[model samples]
Target: MANLYDLLAGGFPIDRDKPAFLLGDGSAVSYGELESGAAQVAGHLIARGVEPGDRVALQAEKSVEGVMTYLGVLKAGAVFLPLNAAYTPAEVDYFLGDAEPRLFLTDPAAFVAEARTAEPLAAAVPRADGDLASLIYTSGTTGRSKGAMLSHGNLAANAVALHEIWGFTPGDVLLHALPIFHVHGLFVALHCAFLSGAPMVWLPKFDDAQVLAGLARSTVMMGVPTFYTRLLANPGFSGEMAAHMRLFISGSAPLLESTFAEFEQRTGMRILERYGMSEAVIITSNPLTGERIPGSVGYPLPGVELRIGGGEATGVIEIRGPSVFSAYWRMPEKTAEEFTADGFFITGDVGRQDADGRVWISGRAKDLIISGGYNVYPKEIELVLDEMAGVTESAVVGVPHPDFGEGVVAVVIGAGDEAALIAACRAQLAPYKSPKRIVFVDDLPRNAMGKVQKNLLRERFGSLFMA
Candidate 1:
């Protein structure tokens, strides 16, 4: 079987009775359930006329059913499109219009229940290396979302690389609290456990109380910067509590140097941070056994080619790797513009690489806001705010946030009602993408060329969240 599911499922323990997921209720979901559940889900899709290469969109809360549905989508050779559960109908409308999935699942539990009665499909659908595995929608600078097309080969290679580099084993237990809508939780984290046949102590979301309890039973944990900060704030998260854990990995947002240092001081362990995007799942990762440094994303994985663009000491990061997505869905021109003539994908991140090959990300060339590990694009919200009745124009920028890595701040050049504008945004965009604060201004600071100086706005309101 060429399906990505085959590759992952092949690594399962010979004894299917072994647990694959250890839930909070003291019960366990065995690896055998994954196999049978996926088969039935595949049968359900096939019965619904879903074919290989078709899209299957899912917008539901995280649960065991959600994980099983993801596996079922792969087994059926369909592209899995996972949307944020927080997305409003307005935001979800755009994704549904763009991707046009053959089946849209809003109720994962019901779908799994329905799938249980379907005839089991004993084998996975054959998928070629170039066959699409997923469509990850990332908002563009133009306020439109582009679905990054990931292939089976792309995921398999990245999963294998990450599984090997992370030193995962059957004995390791992963503490999973991250959302599965995007790459971090959906692919990077899940693949590691699947490849090693390791069980995950699954938590729906990051809660201080639940995580503290889960940590005691887990050996390896993966999370974003916010998770670490929240855990640190809890008095219960002492070094003694995390002493049983072997590794703590962080990514999906920039981990503040202060938090990293403080976490080490409190826990007696340094959190390994990595760099990635929707285009490429995991580009660079800090070493497992070696010294993990603060503010550095460490070295690129084996077989990944990374270089700073324009031959400058510090410039845009460019990469060519098996894990990198081939192109934006249905946007050939856009895809062509993003890649260099030599085929390296422009990562749109401004950074530098040391002579020893370690990479340091200074900033993003694109004004992307990663709030609480979710990618929130300013242009997406700015477009909504600019069209409001009382707003002349708006500039959205991300400022420092204590819990969330960044907080969205909107500065407008009109006499718009602040509360009304925020309410409108909340109605249209997801909560994380909506502006936390709205500042009415006489005029937006602009460059001599008349372009809005978002940098200046960021500086002005940078202390709002911190203070």
Candidate 2:
């Protein structure tokens, strides 16, 4: 049986009495309890007519029961599809309609309670390596969100690689504060802990005080750049709090170089930043025991093959790996279009690979700006804007221009003289590369994962150069 859960089950502590989750209230969920809870939930799914290969959708808040439900779905030989809890009714409607799951869980706690009455399933259902395990929807920055079909082999491969590369041991305790809806929290973070049979310190979401308190007991923490930034802002967080921690892994968004430097100054430890997407859970990661360079996502995993698509200094990223998803669920045309005939998936992320195979992402291919027939990469411009006086951070976008086909526009997060900012860019870049206009705001719009939504910025300022 190639069931992913079986692999996780095999990794559980030989003594099942060990804790699976260490709670803030001094309570703990034992590995034994987790196993039985999953059995009951699997039995409930079977009783509810959910068959092997059937889709089960979940859009609910983070909870212990939610994790149980996920494990149970796998045990029942069903495909698990997780939707963002923060999504609106209409947004949820689209996902549910598209996935067409046999069961949709709105309240995980209720389901857990109902499942307890059911008989526990004796064992996990058998599955092949290629059987679909989950459907993770993309961020939908430039188009409709596509459901990436990840298989048992895909999840297992990535989990095993991460568990080994990140060095998760039985004694490690993970401080897990991210939401379970996304890949960073659910697949990458949770999978590692489960694969190592290590316990996690669970929180409903990222809270400053809770995270600070949790740091005292955690051995490892995997979170987005925003988590680190918020911690830096809090006065209570200090190097001593994280002194005992072994690793801090960041992903899901770019870690600003300033944040990286500041964190090292405060904690005397460099963060391990990785690169990944929904299509492939995680492709490249900085070394756990080697050089963790700032702004670089580091090397590809052991079995993964990566290359720049256009053979240029900077181009779209393409990869072939076991961890890569099989296809987009029910979207044959879109699926075929995303992958090359040679079997590499075109990641649509513009980046470059160094001689040593280290990766540096510039921006999305779709986010590329064209002004006066010259190529303008937003990341290149954003880096320049970010260093200017009075600018905390910046998002560069291309808007309609009366003269140039498209005009460069900078949506900044702090106050600055527009002329001086534009002048600064012109001094460092070509005239066409400089922003035609600069707009200051309190903050840039970000998604649930802390990624700046460049599409929204383009829409908001699309009419900037029209007049």
TM-score of each: 0.80, 0.98
Off by over 4 Å in 2: none
**How many steric overlaps are in each model, in order?**
0, 0
What are the per-residue Cα lDDT tens digits for candidate 1 across 172-269?
Answer: 99999988898889999999999999999999888898899999999999998778878888888899999989999998866766678889999899
Model 2 residue 43 lDDT score: 98
lDDT of 2 by residue, 119-185 (tens): 9998899998899999999988777999999999999999999999999999899999999988899
Give the Cα lDDT of each candidate: 0.88, 0.92
Instruction: State model 2's lDDT.
Output: 0.92
- Score residue 355 of candidate 1 by CA lDDT: 82
Report residue 147 deviation for candidate 1 (angstroms).
0.2
Query: What is every candidate's alpha-carbon RMSD to the true fold?
Result: 11.1, 1.0
Residue-level error in angstroms, candidate 1, position 353: 0.4
Supply the TM-score for candidate 2: 0.98
lDDT of 2 at 6: 93
Worst 10 residues of 1 by lDDT: 445-454
